[model samples]
Target: MTTEIIDHEEVHAFTIRKEIEIAAPIEIAFEAILDELGADAQMPDGKSLSMKIEPWPGGRWFRDLGNNAGHLWGHVQVIKPPTLLEITGPMPMSYPAVNHVQYRLKANGNETFLTFAHRAMGLIQPEHRDGMPEGWTQWINQIRERAEQKARG
Candidate 1:
């Protein structure tokens, strides 16, 4: 059987949100995200891309090269450690795009509820646009695992 392909009507902005409840405290969960995004989100080569987050408002988040020569991933628009973090910029995208992502966490007794939103506006390619939903879910699960492990030890 042949597969049906969807046709694009126009270029549009896309927004995606994902959430997970980690069996760890808010601090642990938040740190897990920071660590994961900067290092643990794996690539095809069994290794993760390098990243550096400034961790404060007006700070920057980007690929970290040893000699400070790297691409700018985004800038920290808002930051409230263990609670919220927001970024805005071009991200890792090559196209002319605007990207924003937010990480929010809330403490419920011992466990922490983590949520994030990723929004991209530009001429998004079909391949890049289609894969995000599942990709982000996997990334979140990985972060959750790291947080839980940190909490345990």
Candidate 2:
């Protein structure tokens, strides 16, 4: 077998962080996060992904495709109601990589500050890296919309 060495740039890691303010309480924002990332998960085009999060330490975060077939996105490393959540796993990478995602919430009177971060290392592909920011932003926007809608009701 022949050995091939990859370029340093091709194997580099990355981190993405985004902070958004929601016109909703911390609890509502947190619940919106769970909903958007879990049962209410969807593609940019609004197609449901049927995702699920067990919501406890060591719980599974995955997409259920039915018939016992699905994709394991990650495991809940930490979960604190109305405050923080951290998960570790492949998370849509599906390759020789490790990923950690965190959602932190802070309450400010009647508003909430939501901070999200995703860090990964390994053979991450160009397309995945390029698309992640937009994809994550879409999810974040959805969470904000959901929370704000509930708050307005």
Candidate 3:
């Protein structure tokens, strides 16, 4: 499994691409990625906050990262079960921003290839881009752990 960071000047966006072989079926991997609340909880620096997802197209995907410091409030833009899932939400920073996230899954024998991309729009510091890959790596690793555990049982 490898992780890569891509920076695009045209869109003024930075993307973190993580590829991990989870010891789980594709369907299970997809579910883990779509588990918004669970995923947030597993975030390396996340503090629970308040997360709720409707799990359908045009459904609400909202979270309050406690303390009013950062939050995610948006809707599920696209949902193709066990394959792709996308969500758009407000940025966690002070600047007016929007975040678009996508999860892609591919099945290989008994393993699953999962890739995630998070694009942040608006005023993003150039230096911040450099650290995004690490943050995403941690998140994906957590996802892999959870999915594999589910598969084992």
What are the models' TM-scores? Answer: 0.86, 0.93, 0.76
**Regarding TM-score, does 2 or 3 come out ahead?**
2
- Better lDDT candidate (1, 2): 2
Query: What are the per-residue Cα lDDT tens digits for candidate 2 across 27-82?
Result: 99999988987999999777899999999999999999999999999999999998
Runs in model 1 lying further than 4 Å from the true structure = 1-10, 65-69
Model 3 segments more than 4 A misplaced? 1-11, 36-40, 43-47, 64-70, 126-130
Task: Rank the models by lDDT, top first.
Answer: 2, 1, 3
Number of the top-ranking candidate, with TM-score as the measure: 2
Per-residue CA lDDT of model 1 for 1-153, tens digit only, reads 899885654666999998889999999999998887676657545576777777888988888767858888899998888899899998777777888999899999889998889999887777777887877887788889999999999
Q: Rank by TM-score, descending?
A: 2, 1, 3
Clashes of 1: 0
C-alpha positional error of residue 6 in candidate 1 after TM-score superposition, expressed in Å: 23
Model 1: C-alpha RMSD to truth?
6.8
